[model samples]
Structure formats: structure tokens, C-alpha cells
Target: MRTRLAAVAENFGRDLDAAYATIDRLLRRARAEGTGLIALPEACLGGYLSSLGSAEDRGTAETRRQRSGPPALALDGPELRRVQEMARDVVVVLGICEDGGTDRYNTAVALTGDGVLGVHRKVHQPLGENLSYAAGSTFEAFETPVGRIGLQICYDKAFPEAARTAALDGARIIVSISAWPGARTAAAADLAQDRWKKRFDLYDQARALENQVVWVASNQAGTFGSLRFVGSAKVVGPGGDVLADTGVDTGVAAADVDVEAELDAARRAMFNLRDRRPDVYGALVREPAHA
Candidate 1:
């Protein structure tokens, strides 16, 4: 089955109404384009952290009291329900700051008109992120209309184990949603030349090739508060080929792929999953001796 997939690179702020408007517009375009699955940037619902790594990033006491972070939303809240309604036949993957009672989680959710399909809380918290959200515990795959899919957020892409675990669990496609920003210091004037942006693109390809799974990466574009996002949304083939990309701009990268066919073709010559030597990799699951 050839499925049309799209990954978006766009800015989303604190205004819920504005976010919904953007989502509605994107959904309309996806529907018209016959997109079966679409991935939106992290915190597309309420936006990502204003800044990172410094006390000032958290702001003054008064500022923190006024607006500490993105609004925390429940998984079953009206916000997601609205997304489900907009999703209809399309499988939509997006990020949010999940309201986990006393704790908040940077979560990614996959949904359709019927309801939620799967959820993934970011397991790797970068920089000052630990100050805002709790870490997730596992990486798992779930069945969706498009195919068996896995979800990850932002910094999780840096770890090979994260994508490998999902692939081992039978995920044919992995959707990674992020609000990734450029290099914080000595930043490149052109975002396309930024080292962090290069890493973002490299990881998308490397993860896809190593795992032999289709990779869809969506990221926030433009600056938000003190951070400048590196928008490089893309769809990569199992062979590490970039099928489509939004570059360093705000747009959608769309591609049509037959999931099973692509996987079969890619794995025919080099079956990474089948030839794994798990016995020698025992240390991967063990705690660090120093820690």
C-alpha cells in the first residue's frame, strides 16, 4: 500500500487558538494532497521552552508566576479531541506538554478520527529540559492505518537505542517530532550552515538507515523567544535517502511510499535486524559503573 506521508516545519506559539488555526490549515492541505500520515513539530499545541541552560531562561520570579511554561494539556482534553476531529482519515502525529497531574511530560501522540493510536513521552531530556518535564521509560511500536509506527520527541533521536528498540518491536516507520534549535553559541548566520542543523539532518538519515525503517522528522521553524529553531523537516528512506525535505524553511516535506515494499527491498541485501549479535551487546542494558 503506497501511503502519502508529510512532515512539517513551522512555528507554533503559546496561543491555543492560533495553534488550532495552523493545524486546521495544514490538515486541509494534507487532505487535499491525499496524505495518509502527517507529522507536526514538537509542542505544536502550545509551543516549546522559551529558552534553555540558564537561570534567566526560567525567567524572574514574577515572570515565572505569570507564565512559567507551555500550558499543560491532558491527553483526553478537548485540544486533542479537536485534533482527532481534524485528523479524520489522516494519521496525525504531534507533540504537546502533557499534564501528568503533578508532573508534566513532553509527549508525542499519534491519532486519527477514531481516536488516539499511540503515545510517547520524551525519554531523553536535554539541557534544562529536566527542570520542566519528567522522562519516559520505554520505546514501543503500535499499529496504525498507515503501518506499524513508533513515536519519539526531539533529543531522543541522538540515541541509537531509542530507534533500535522501536524497530526491534516491529515499527516500519518512526515519526520524530522536535522543536530543535540551532547552535546556542557562535551560531551560523545561515541556519543551513548550523552544526546542530547538520546533526538534525544526519540523525534522521542515520536512524532510518541503521534501523531499516522509514523516518519522518518534523521541527519548529523560525525563532521563538530566545531560541532560534532549525527547521529541517524531512522524510528519509530505509536506505538513508532523503525522499523529501523542507530545508531550513517553513513548509511540508511530503512523499509517497509503500512501507512493506521499501523495507523488503532495503533489508534484502543487508539485514541489520536479522544479523544482530545481542549477546555481545549486554552492556547496553547495564548501568554505567561510574554512575
Candidate 2:
């Protein structure tokens, strides 16, 4: 049973109404295309950080105040409810700045018309991200109508362990949502040539190949504040081949794949999971010794 999956590459901002409108339009298109699952970019509800680095790095007290970060939304808030209504039957995965009482988290959620099926708080915070949000402690795979799926936010994909952990927990598909920006210094004239863009694409392929799972990557497009995004949304097969891609533009990358068949074929020859030597890898869990 082949299922159609779509990964979106489009810009979203602080305006909730505008974001909702974009989401509504995307959902409509996915429905028309008969997409079973759709993945939206990180911070698709509000937006990502206007800039990386710390407030002190930018200088000026007013500049620091301006970088306070995106609106913190509750998991059960009306904002998500609206998305749920729009989702209806499609399994939608997207990111948000979660309001966790005293703390704020960079979170991703998988949902349908029924309600949220799974949630993941980004465990790895890059640059000065920790200043804005608290770190998550685990990578979990949960059951959804689409399949056993896992979620990862920007920066989370940089760590191989993040995706590997989810695969070990039985995830057949991984949706990685990112608001990834291009090189800040000496950037390429063509976004396709950007180093960060290359890294972003490489991570998607490597993670899928290693886990032998379907990979869907979504990212922000165009500019937001001082940051310029790469916008290379794509879908990768278990063999690490790109099934569909939006390139360096705003569009949806859609692919039809029978997830179970692909995984079975990839694992049949060299079953990485079954060949694991857990006893010899004890150092993986040890705390690093700082100089």
C-alpha cells in the first residue's frame, strides 16, 4: 500500500492569521493530491528566531528585548485546534514554541482531526537557543495512522543518535522540520551552492539510509529578519535516494512510497539493527571528560 507524503517549504511569520491561512492552503492542496501525511517547517505556527547568537552578541538593550523569541503556545491551545480542524484526515506534523508553564520548549507535534497523536521537544539546542528555550531529554517514536513515526526539529538532525534512538524504538518514518538558514558569512549567490544547504541535505539522506526508514524534511523558505533560509524540502527513500524535492524554492515535495516494503528490502541484506553490538558500545552512554 503506497502512501503519498508531502513536505512543505514555505515561509511563516509572527502573524498568526497569515500562518493559519498558509497552512489552510497547504492542507487543501495535500487533500487534493491525496497525501496521507504532510510535514510543515519548524515554527510554522509563529516563526523561528529572528537571528541566532545571543542578545548580548547583538548589543543594545532594545535589540535584546526584540529577540525575546516567538509566541509560546500551549499544546491544547486554540491555535493547534484550528490546525486539527484543517488536518481532518491527514496526519500533519509541525513545530511550535511550546509554553511549558515556567519554561518554554521548541516542540513538534503530530496530529489529525481527532487530536495530537505525538509530541517531541527538541533535545538539542544550537547556538544561543538554550537562552530562549529549555532542552528536551528524549527522542521517542509514536504510533500514528500514517505509520510508526518520529519527529526532529532543527539542530536535532545534526546528531545521529537522535534519529537512531527513534529507529531503535520502531519508527518507520521520520519527519524532520527545520527553519535552517544559509551561511551568515561569505554566502553563495545561489542557495543551491550554500554549504549549510549541502549539510542539511546530507543529514536527511544519511539518517534515512542508516535507519532504513522513510525520511521527510521540511524547511522555511525566503528571508525572516536577518536570516535567509535554504528551503530545500525533500523526501528520501530507505536507500537514501531522493524521491522528490522542492530544490531551493518554496513548494511541496511529494512522494508515493510503500513504507513497509521499502524497509524490508533495505534490511534484508545487512540488518543494521540486528547486527548491533550493544556490549562493546558502552562508552556511547558515558559522560565526556572535559579538559
The number of clashing residue pairs in each candidate reads 0, 0
lDDT of 2: 0.92
Name model 2 segments beyond 4 Å from true.
Answer: 54-68, 288-291
Model 1: CA > 4 A from native: 57-67, 287-291
Clash pairs detected, candidate 1: none
TM-score of 2: 0.95
**What lDDT does the true structure give each of the candidates?**
0.94, 0.92
lDDT of 2 by residue, 149-184 (tens): 999998999999999999999999999999999998
The CA root-mean-square deviation of candidate 2, after full C-alpha superposition on the true structure, stands at: 2.2
How far residue 20's Cα lies from its native spot in candidate 1, in Å, is: 0.7
